[model samples]
Target: MTTSSYLTVKALTKYIKRKFDADPHLREVYVKGELSNVKIHSSGHIYFTLKDDAARITAAMFRTQASKLKFKPEEGMQVYIRGEVNVYESSGIYQLYVQTMEPDGVGGLFVAFNQLKERLQKEGFFNPNFKQPIPKFPNTVGVLTATTGAAIRDICTTINRRYPLAEIVIYPTVVQGENAAPNIVKNIQLANNQQLCDVLIVGRGGGSIEDLWAFNEEIVAQAIFESRIPIISAVGHETDTTIADFVADLRAPTPTAAAELAVPNQHELIQRIISNKSRLQQMTSALVQFERSRLKKLQNAYPLATPERLYRPFIEKIVQLDMQLGRASQMYLMKKYNALQKLDSTIKSHSPKNEIQYNYKQINHMTDLLTRSVLSLLQKKKDQYGANVRTLEALNPLSIMTRGYSVTYKEQQVVKSVTQLSKDEEIDIHFHDGKVQAKIIEIHEGGEK
Candidate 1:
């Protein structure tokens, strides 16, 4: 018989690893159990045990998977883990590898809180619209918390130290446990209804999730949201968050911080007021100096200093004008007088008495010569007139009538020859003295020959 060679341990382990990797159901599984013997390694791996009341199985979470846990896994903590059940192959032992884990009971509560937060945010309950501004100088501060807790004492001490004048009104209520949410909401409403303070601080000291759960209640959140007064939420430490923190107008990291935010320091406020008063005094002094200088300048002005000095130039100008007017009137009178004197001299030199005497002598001599010339011209004219008259008388037609001559007319026209007269025609006869109408009694062909 031929003897087969035995597989080495390394080869057997490799074969087991291969079988584990090939089995999909063995590679991945989820286990729910209470955790035990929990140990965190320097490399961030977690070694623990997952067991029921009767049985137990070893579990390991590598650094990469362990780092993702929201809450630290402690001994006796119940959790749900998702990972693989695989053989280590070196030790020939099978163990569960945890890839993900969540706190068995708290995880559901966390999920519910997140869902509500998202819903409230979407509905604008946490919007800036609902956020009241903190009073700059709160005279009275209202605190809503357990009357016996350290949170209230811390707040009162901080407020007293920073602003002594501030009056603290404590609205005592339970800050934790089952009845805490209703008490908190009622006290917040009472504070607002009383209008007893300028600002409100609603919070308590830090604690675990279960202890801090009252602040995360919806009733507490709604009370904070409906507050007319500004509210500062200081429920827990910086790492702890509550619904009140989201719904409050402002959030402070601790109870002492909330008190600091509530009131102003009296010393700093007094310093600022003093600084402002000093500035006002300085401005007043400068204004008074400016006005005084202006008044002095007005007093130094010539018109205000001496009224007569302002009118001196006008008086001098009027006097000069009067002197010029006097000189002009005198010059005009002298010119008129000179013109009249020349007229008087010209009249005396050419008098009408002298002119009349010279005219009389010239007239007497001219009259004698004119008389002789007139007599000679008259004699010449008379002789010419007689000769013209005789020439006219010789050519007159009436001379023929004076010598027994007459004229005969036919049809009112003179008949110079016998042939011109017509037989039995009306005729007219004209002598030197008168004319007579007639008719031809016979016809004569020729002049009597």
Candidate 2:
């Protein structure tokens, strides 16, 4: 090969780029392999190797395409990458510039993510109703993450910069692997039980799904759900999402973003409070001014404010009251005078002297008539009384005895009938002249005429 006859490195690279762009098959291709030696760039680009047991290829994804990847490609993660295969003459290396990538054969991280997502969702951890709203102005913020991670540093720095008034309480926790989940869960529960914070930030820096799996654990999700205080989940970069995100009261895309969300900017809040206070003072002053103006208007319109204006009306009312009182008194006196005149006329017509003489004359006539009639009635009553007395005296037994009549009595009773006498019945006989002892004679039946 003659080096002078061949193209230079830049020329060859340009030619290869043109060739790859022109060839549709080479421009859009699909490849499957396991990822290795992955290095993520600050510019968001990713460089790695795609290898199998038999072959390997150097791969690259620019920031745009790398940002679209759902799962992080690591040293041993299987993935399917779609991109153009091209030659880079600078390093004389043949590589794949990936456009899109997905897990190869359903990566373990993806499977775990889906499985945990479904399980937590089934357990109601992702229910919107269970979410607690983050406090707008948190007094204290509890952070559950590694003490050494950049996540806690970034969060603390951002919170201190934005809201210096809020207390930053770090519940240091392991943020990866098996022990990470239990530590995270314990910190969350401890934060809640202690009531140390008004809001909680459970998060860590971005990592592969395996590195971030602690946030996806059922225990961590349950701990977040059971927290009485609101939780903001910030586990990864903007594109990175986790089960903790869905179950959290609020999901911030990054730890810095979560810090920005956790509390208001102190300067802005103080400005707003001052503005409101000024507005309230202004409104109160305006209200007082309005009331004062109204009072002034009322005072100007009131008769008491101008006492001379009331004199004519007051004098007119007094004159009218005097006329009414005069008319009422005249009417009262005239009524009394007429009543007295009528009484005097009645007294003249029925004087006591004439009434007494007339009454006396009527009483004298009635007395004479009553005396004559009473004397006649008394003589009749006296004659009747004497006749009744004489009859009563004649019918008396004593009177009969005095007339030579006698009555016989037995057992102190007069025997007026023969049935009253019984044979051999001893009895005392009582005659008109005296009493004697007697016995009943036999053979007396009914021979009396």
Candidate 3:
């Protein structure tokens, strides 16, 4: 048997890769399928599987191409991919190298719009708190639209007619085509930097969605959102709305409406002035009549009609005060006179002669009573002294000695009982006339002698 040489896996993979690369048909292919396992790597490259009911294929998009995509690819989303087919030698797998990808059947512009809207919304660009209010009556209106377009003309005409005082500063901008978004952004920045206008009107005449797409761009939306000058977005017709509208301070249905909003109507103002003048005249006449009636009433009032009426209470108060003063003076004088009389009577009662006579009478009466009380007290004391003398004589121990009684003491203490004396103790016998020293010979008990 003849041995045939076979190719290695690496060699076979490279060979297939080269074949796919060289083929004009496979070099650039457009395929439609549902995305699966979509992943965006840290390097910004995207890898996903594109599969249909029949077959599935792996696809990769490099960072550069993937960056151009306006929307993120989600798994199971239907997509149309334009790429080259190739094989990776390391993995030995065939894959699609994606150059461009978009949602199936949907316009790329709409996708971009939705994506930017969603992203900016998440970042709070469409936050109502950031929205500025358009000036009701702008002194200078800055219009960012094509100079030759109907939008400018309408705005200028409306402003000139409605508010002739307002100065219109036109920042001629391209509002359509490729340069439209950048031009809009530039003019907005310029207008803001220049500080030329109180209010900014950014718009174009009514147009198709394509012509109006510039206002929907992220750059335009960001510029409008960041501008300190209040912006009114009037893109396309009333039915059309753009990202600029959502981000701007205000959105006008049309350019003319934007102009009208920026200024007040001159005719309306004039009519208001006239109506105010009439109201003022009516009010002034009414006020004058009211004041005149008030003056008449004041003149006819009691105080104004009779000048003395104002002073009547003061006059009556003075009369009453005078009468009270007279009465008070009389009462005070009477009280002082009565007090003087009482004092004079008191002085008279305290005269020296009368005081001496009164004291002498008191002394005489007291002396008489003292004389009788002294005699009675002396008699009672005499009787008490006699009674005490008799009591003493009756209680006297010397008297009892004269009656043949005596007291015996041992060691200077009176002995009351025979047992009190010791047999050999010295004692004294006290009698009425003498005290005799003696010795206790015996102590007698009972009747023994």
Give all TM-scores, in the order shown. Answer: 0.46, 0.47, 0.67
The global C-alpha lDDT for each of the candidates, from Candidate 1 onward, is 0.88, 0.86, 0.90
| Candidate order, TM-score descending | 3, 2, 1
Local accuracy of candidate 1 as per-residue lDDT tens digits, 364-436: 9999899999999999999999999999898788986889889887776778787776678888889888989
| Cα lDDT over the full model 2 | 0.86
User: Quick one: how many clashes does candidate 3 have?
Assistant: 0
Candidate 2 vs 3: which has more lDDT: 3
- Candidate 1 residue 11 Cα shift, in angstroms, is 57
What TM-score does candidate 3 get on C-alpha atoms?
0.67
TM-score of predicted structure 2: 0.47
Better of 1 and 3 by lDDT: 3
Reference-based lDDT, residue 167, model 1: 94
Model 1 regions more than 4 Å off: 1-106, 306-449
